[model samples]
Target: MPYLPARAVATLRLLFATLLLAPLAAQAQAEPDGDNSQSPYFSVHSDDPANDRLPLKSTQVRARVLGVIADVTVTQHYRNEGSRPLEAQYVFPASTRAAVYAMQVRIGERQLNASIREKQQAKQEYEAGKLAGKTSALLEQHRENVFQMNVANILPGDEVAVELHYTELLVPTDGVYRFVFPTVVGPRYNGALATGSGTAEPWIATPYQCTAATTDAVGAAAIDESAPVFDLQVQLATPTPVRELVSPSHAIDIDKGADNQSRVRLAAATTIANDRDFILDYRLAGDRIESGLLLSKGSEENFFLALVAPPKAAPSQLIVPREYLFVVDISGSMHGFPLDTAKVLLQRLLAGLRPSDRFNVMLFSGSSSLLAPDSQPANADNIARALTLLDTEMGSGGTELLPALRQALAVPGDQERARSFVVITDGFVTVERDAFELVRKHLDQANLFAFGIGSSVNRQLIEGLARAGQGEPFVVLDKASAAEQAERFRRMIDAPLLTHVQARFEGLDTYEVEPPALPDLFAQRPLVLFGKWRGEAKGRLLIEGQQAGGAYRVELPIRADQAQAENQALALLWARHRVASLTDQETLEGDFAYSQAILDLGLKYHLLTPYTSFVAVDEVVRTAPGTSPAATPQPLPLPQGVSPLAVSPLTVGAAVPSTPEPSTWAMLLIAALGGLLLHRRGPRGAGGTV
Candidate 1:
C-alpha cells in the first residue's frame, strides 16, 4: 500500500545492482545448491578479455506469418576477435511451442547443412571435430525454451554463422494473436541437489553484463558495441483484414499492404540489445476468428491440422462457493518490479472475491508462511489482514517453489467446495519438471492457475505448471495490466468456453494423434488437433463439446485436394508435439522412460529435442594440435529489470563486491527484527493501531 510505483522500484533497484546485490544475497543466505547447479559469475574485462574474444557479434531474424502458422529463421554470427584459436558458447531461448527442424553452418564460401542425430552422438561428433581442428557448431536443448549453441575451434580472424529454422502454430486467444521471440534465458534458481536440472547444465554458468542499468525513459546512456545487436523483420499475412497492429515490447514500423498483409520491422536506427523477449500482438479486422483445417501431403506421411473455434463464455450470474489458495513468490529475482506488479495483481484478485468464498494466502522465499492456519472467509477483515501481511514483505532469498507447493497441497480444504489455487511468480526456478509432476499427481485436489510476473519470465515453467495442473497460465508484464489479467482470471474460473470435447474421424485413416484425448477449453482459442492420415485425406472431422450450458458441435470436410506445400511444416509440428508430450511424461516419472521414442521422432522429423541435437562440422582442418586454444563463454546482458545478483559474484579472476559479509547480514537482520518488535509494543501501549 505505501510503496513506490512498481516501475520506480524496479529502476532504483536495477541502478544500484552493483552496491546492493551482495548484501541482499548475504541476507537471503541460501545454502550450497547441492545438485551441481551452476550460477552465473561476473566477467572481468582485465583478464586478457578483448572484443574479439566475444565471438558472438549479432543475431539476424526473419519470420513469415501465414494465417495460423509462423516460420522463423534465426542466424547467429560469431567472429573470433582474439588472435589465437578459441571456441565460443552462448545460451539463448525460444518459444516453448517452437518446432525447430533445420540448422545450417556457413564458413566463408563453404556451407554445411546440419543433421539431426542422438544427443550423445551429436556431442561425440562435435568433440571429434574439435579435436581434429575442424570448425563445428552444436545446438542442444537445456529446457523446453532454453537452448545452447557451441561453435568450436574458430581460428584467428575466422567467422562462423549458425542458422536455426523453426516453425510454430499460432493459436489466438480472445481474438488476439501473439508471437514471442525470447532473446535470452533468465537465470534460474537451482534448488537443493539440483536434482531436476538435467545433466551438468553448464549453460547456467554463463557471464552476465552488470555495469550499466537504465530505464526506457532514460534509454541506454551508453551502448556496448561489442555486445550483440538484434535485428528482426516479420511479414504477416492473415486471412482477414488487419484491424490492429502493435508491439508493446519494442518500437516498430508497420507497413500495411493490400488484403490483410503487412510488413513489420524494427524502427529505423532503433535496434536494441538482446536483453528481453520481443512480443508482437495483433487482431484481425472482425470479431470472428480465422480457424479451419490445414493439410500437408508429404512423400511418406500425410498430415492434417484442425483448428475448431469454441463458443463464447457464458455469463457468471450464479456464484459458486470455492476454496481458494493464493501462492506468492518473494524471491531475490522478483525483488522490485516483479514483486510490485504481483502485489497489485493480488490486490485486485482478493478484493474481487465474494464474501461466500473461502481463501488463504501463502508467501514463499527460501521459506514459506501462511496468512492463517486454514482457509478464511473472503470477508473485508480477512482480506485486509492478507494484504497487510503481503505489504510487509520485501522480496529476498532463493526461490524454493517445490517445497512450498508440497506444503500447499497438504493443506486441508472443504470437500464440498471446488478447490482452486492461484500461483503468482516470475517462474525462475530449475525444478520445473518436478513441480509439474507434483501438480499433475494431485490434480483431482485442485486446479492451479499461474500468473507469470516479469518482463521476460520463464514461460516454459508457467505454461508447464498450468498444463500439468489442468488449468490455465496468464502473464502480466506490468502493473498496468494487472487488473485486466485479474479480471480474465475471474472470468475463466466462472466457466469454460467448451468442455467434454470429443473428436471423431469418419472415413479418415488418422493415426498417431498428438493428444489422444482433449481437455476443456477455457478461452476463445481454437481447439487444435494434429495427426497423420494414410491414403486419401477424404473424411469428415466431427467435434462435439459442451458450451455455455448447451451442446456444441462442429463438422468440417477434409480432402486430399486441400493439401498445400506450405503445410509441410505440419509434419514437423506433429513430431515436435509428440516429443513434447513424451518429454512431459518422462519428467513426471522422474526418468527417461520415453527418451528413445522422443529421439526417434526428432531424427525422423529432422527436429531438435533433449534426446537429440543438431551438429554441423566442416571437414577441412583449420588448426594444428600444437596451437594453444581457449574456450570463451559469451557473456549475456542481464534481462531487463533483473538485478545483478541473479548471477553469482564469484568467478575466476573477478573482483568480489565489497558489502556486508554473510554473518554480518544475519546479525543485522536479528537486531532489526528485535527493534521492530519493541517499536510495535510501544505503539500498542500508546493506544495506537499497530
Candidate 2:
C-alpha cells in the first residue's frame, strides 16, 4: 500500500474517480410517491429515491493509484459495522470548482478507493461548468459524481471504515478555512449519511496553519489570531470509539490503545494577541470560574456591596400579607422534561412559606383541581403532603389557560394576606387578550408570578399575566435552568426586602424608565431597572423603602464631586419606582403610557414578552410597528442553504426537496450493471497506496 510516489499517484486517483461517476448523471431525476405512516422498524429499498431512507442489498469498492513523483502511494481500507445489511452507495457531488483526486470506503476488513468518472449528462455538464470557484454546490441541485453499491446483508454488530488517499490541491487563503464533512442522515447516493452513533467515532484531520492575523482583520472579534497553516482535528462519537475528548480551541491527538479504549490528548500551541484584552477561558470539568485580577501599583481597597434581602417585612413597614395562590399547568406537552422540572421548583417555593402565610395549589389541564377544599396557612404536615401529591399527578389533556386562571383566582384562599398568585406552565396556549382581561379583573392586592418552560413558551401571555397581576415572570429554557429559577422563587417566599418604592427626581426633566412601581424584593431575583436619562446634575435625592412596619428614609447625598455616582443613583431610583409602577398600575393616576412603552420595547426586541415570541425569522418584524421610533428594520430574506444534520424534528423533510427518488426495478438494473461491469473489469491494478 505504501509503495508509490505521491505526485504520480495523485494523477491516477483523479483518473479512476472520473470513471465511476458518469452513469448517475444520466438518470438522476426521481419523483415523489408520498406515503406517510409510522413504521416502528427501518425499511430498506432500492430504485425509488424517495425510499432512500431504507437500505439496499449490498456493495463492494476497490481503489488504487501510484504517485511516482511524490514517492508515496495511498492505502485504503473498508469495513462494515452495521446492524442490518448496508447497501453502500457512494456519490461524489459533481464539482467543477475543485477536482477530487481520490475517495475510499471502509467495509469490514477491506478498504478500497472509489472509481471516478466525468458525468456527461446535459444538466451535470451545465452545472459543473457554472460552478467555477464555489466550494459547495448546495444551491445547484443536479451535478453529482460518486459510486454507491450495497452490502446485501450486514447482521447486527457490524462496522465499516472507508479510507481514501489522494493529493488534494492545497489552496491558500487569508481567512480561517473550514472543511466540514457532511453528517446528514439521508440517502447513501446523496453522500450525506456520514455521522456515527453510540460507541464509534469518525475523525477528520487537516495540516498546519499558513499565516497569522488579528480578529479585526478577520471580522470575528472573538478569535484573537488566524494562522495560515491551521491544523484542525474533529471527531464524532460512535460504537467503535465510545468516548472521544475534544476541546473547542485546540487540537486533540487520538490514538488507539490496547485495552479497547481510545486515548485522546488535547494540546494548545499558538496564542493570538489583540489590542483590547487577552484572556483564557477554561472550565476544568465542573469547577467554578477562577480569575486573575491585575492590580495597579497603589490601589488596595476592593469596595464591594453584598445586598442580602431579609426574610419577611417588619410590622412597621408597608405591610402587605400576600394571599398566595398557585396555578399549575398539567398539559400533555409538559409530561416530559417541562412538568418534571416545574414540580421540583414548586416544592422548593412551598418549603419557604412561613406558618402565618396562606396558600393554595390549583392544578389545571382541561379541568382544574385544588390541593385542599379550601386555602390554609402553611404548616409542616400540609405543605409536605402537597409536595407529595404533586409528584403523583401527571400532565395530560388540552391547555385551558382561561378557565384555569379564573378557577385559581376564585379559589377561596388566604384573603386576609396581600393576595399573590403563582402560575407555572409551559405556556402552550394562545388565549391572548381575553386571558389578560381575565387576569386583570380577578387581580387585586395579589400579584402574579409566572414561570415559563420550553423553547416555544408563550412569553407574552405569561409575562402579560404577571404584569396584570403585578408580579414577576421567569423562564426555564431547559432542565439545567430550572434550579436557578426555582431559587428565585424560594428567595421571594423567604422575605420581602422593599415595598411601594417611588421616586421623584428634581434635577432632570421627566424621562422614560422601567418598572414604574416596585415589587417586594426577594433574596434571589436582582432588582434591575431600565430607562433613558436626561438633564444636568444638581441636588441630593431621597431614597425611601418600607421594611416591615415603617418606612426607612435615607438621604442619597449627590455631591458634585461624584457626578457619575449621582446620575446612577438617580437612575436606580427611577428603575426601582418603574418596576413598582408596573405591578401597581391600578394605583397609578396617569395614562398607561409608561407601561405601554415597556410592552412595546419587549415586543420590538423580542425580549421576554408576556405573551408572544418571534418564533420564526419573519416574526422578527411582523408585530413591531414600522412608524414607531423604536422599530427595527426587517432584514431581507436570503436563499435557503442545505444543513448537515437534520437535528430538529421540525426541520426533517421541509428543507430537502419533497420529491424523493423511487426505489424499484430501475435501481436493480443500475446495481446489476455496475456490479457486472466492476467485476468484469476487476479494479484496474494497484494505482495508489495509503
Candidate 3:
C-alpha cells in the first residue's frame, strides 16, 4: 500500500463531493417543462378547464393623437371563473416613454379611482384591505417599461375592469412616426432564485408556464382558443395630411375623416395574441417639419414643451473614411425569427457600406468572436466572408452582451474616421444597466446604434443603449422592413442633422430642463425640450446648431396668454421626464440622491415607479378572510416568432450558465494525477531518512 499526501486526500474528497452533488443541485433548480409525468416537484391534475385558464377576460386600447402628443387609455377586464374568490395579478408592458397618470377600477356600476402612495405604504394598505375581505386594486411599477396590477377579493362569477391612462410624446425619425402597444412581458432569466418574504415585487416570482410543444405553435393555438380579447381603436389627427397609414404588426383598417383626421381599428376576425407587439407607423404628407411650443399651466406650476426641427444639411462630398462594427446576438432567446432578421439586416447594412469604409462583424452568445482580428475594408470579398461566418456560426447560447460590447469597443480604429457600433439583438438579458454604463463610458470613442429585432423586443434595453451611446434606436418587427431600416441607418450615419446644439432662452424664466444638455440630432427627428417656467412666458426660444459647413439657428416666440390651466397632464408629463433624467443620472453616478429625487417626483406626481405605487380600496368588506382564495399567478404569452428552445424550461431570468475554463479542468486533472503518483511513490522510509 502507498501513502497519499494530505493535499491529495483533500482534493479527492472535494472532487467526489462535487461530482455527487451536481445532479441533486440541478434537479432542485429544474424548471417546469410542461410535463406532469416526469416532474415530481408539483402535481398536475386532470381538472376543470375553467379553473386552469387565466382570469383575464378582455383588453381594450384606445388612443387619441393631437399633434405630436398622444393620449392613450388601456382597459383590462378580469373575471373570476373558478369557484373560489381569488386575488389575480397580471404583469404587463408599456412604452418606456409613457407617462402613466391615472388608473381606475370599475366594478359593476361603481368606479374607484386609485391614489398614489409610497410603495411600502401602498403595499401595506392593500394587504390590510385584502385580509379584511374588501375589494381593492394596486398597480406597481416593476421596471421602466413593465408594470404589475393586482386585483383582490374577486368573487366567483364577478368581473372587474381596470383602466389606465397615459400620455406620451411622439417623435419621428426620418419622417416616419411609429406608435407601439406592447401586449406581453417576456419571461425573464434570473440568475438566482429569490428568497425571503417580501411583497415589494411579488410578480417577479410568478411561475412560468412551459409546454412540451414549441412556444410559437402552442402559443398560437392557445391564443386562438383562450386568449383574452382586445378591441383597439385610434383617432389620429395630424397638422398635415396623413399621407400613409400602415400597421406592419397587425391588419388594421383606416378610414379618413375630416380635417386631417383618421380613424383606425383592427381588422375583422383578427385575434390579438398577447405574444406580439402591435405597432402603427404613419408618414405625414410633404417634407415640412412642424416646430412649435405647447404650454400648459397648473395650479402650482407652469410647464412647457418646445419642439424645433433643424434645417436639413446640404449633401457634403468630403467622404471621410468610417469604421462600423456590427455586434449580433446569437443567444437562445434570439434563436428563431430574431436571428434570421438580424442576418438579413446585417447583410443589407454591409451592402450599403462603401469600399472606403472599414467594417467588422462580431457574433456573441456565451462568448464573442469577430470575423477578423482587425477591421477590414468593406470590399466584396470581405463582405462575402462576413456573410459566410454569420451563416456558419449562427446557433443558440447564453446572452453575454457586456463582454461582447467590451470586445467591440476595444477594437481600435483610425481616430480620424468616424467610428460607429451597431448592436442587433432581441435585448433579453437582465444586465441592461451594465451595458448602458459601458456604452456611456466609451461614448466619446464611438457612436452606438441599437437595432431591436423580434416580435416583442425589450424596449428599455434598446432605448437605453442608444441614449447612453448618443445614438438612435430602431425597431424592426418584421422581415419586410429590414431593408427599409437598413437604408434609414445608412442615411442617419452619413451625416447628422444638427451638431454642437445649444439652446438660448431670451426673457423667459426657465429652469430644470429635462435633458440639461442636448446631443447632436440625427436623421429628421425634431428637437424636443421639456421644462418648467416662471414669470411671464413671453420669450424667444433660440436653438442654434452646426450643419455641414456653417452654423444654423431657429427661433420661436412663446406667449403666456395662450396657456391653459386645464391641461394638468403637462405637470405629470414634466415629472415623468424629470424622473427619467434622474434615473439616467443615477445610472451614471450611482448616487442615492438621484434615487431620492426620482422617488420624490414619483410620489408628488402620483406616477407608478419603482419607489411609488397606486393602490385603491373599497370600504365595505366583500368576503371573509378565512375563506379567501389563494393568489393565482397569471401566465404570460410567449412573444411571437420566438421558438420554445429559446425559452428552455430552466430559463428563468435567462441567466447565462457558468462554464469552467479548460485550464481549470486541466489543473484539477494534473493535481489528481500528482496525488496518484505520490501514492505510488510511497512514504519516505525510516532507514532512508536516517
**Best of the candidates, lDDT:** 1
lDDT of 1 by residue, 308-387 (tens): 87787788555668999999997767766778889999999997788889999999877789998899999999999999
lDDT by residue for model 2 (198-295), tens: 11111000001112222221122233221111122222222232332333323446655553334333344433211111111111222211111111
Q: Can you rank all candidates by TM-score, best first?
A: 1, 3, 2
**Which ranges of candidate 2 are over 4 A from the true structure?**
1-323, 355-358, 377-385, 432-434, 454-463, 474-490, 512-515, 523-535, 554-690
Better of 2 and 3 by lDDT: 3
For the record, the alpha-carbon RMSD of candidate 3 to the native fold, in angstroms, is 11.2
Tens digit of lDDT per residue, candidate 3, span 623-666?
A: 99645555765666667776443443432233222223323445
Q: Kindly report which residue stretches of model 3 are placed more than 4 angstroms away from their true locations once superposed.
A: 1-52, 192-223, 626-628, 651-690
Per-residue lDDT for 330 in model 1?
A: 79
By lDDT: ranked, best first: 1, 3, 2
Among these predictions, the greatest TM-score belongs to 1
Name the 10 consecutive residues with the lowest summed lDDT in model 2. Answer: 631-640
Q: Name the weakest run of 10 consecutive residues (lDDT summed) in model 1.
A: 651-660
* Residue 64 local lDDT, model 1: 98
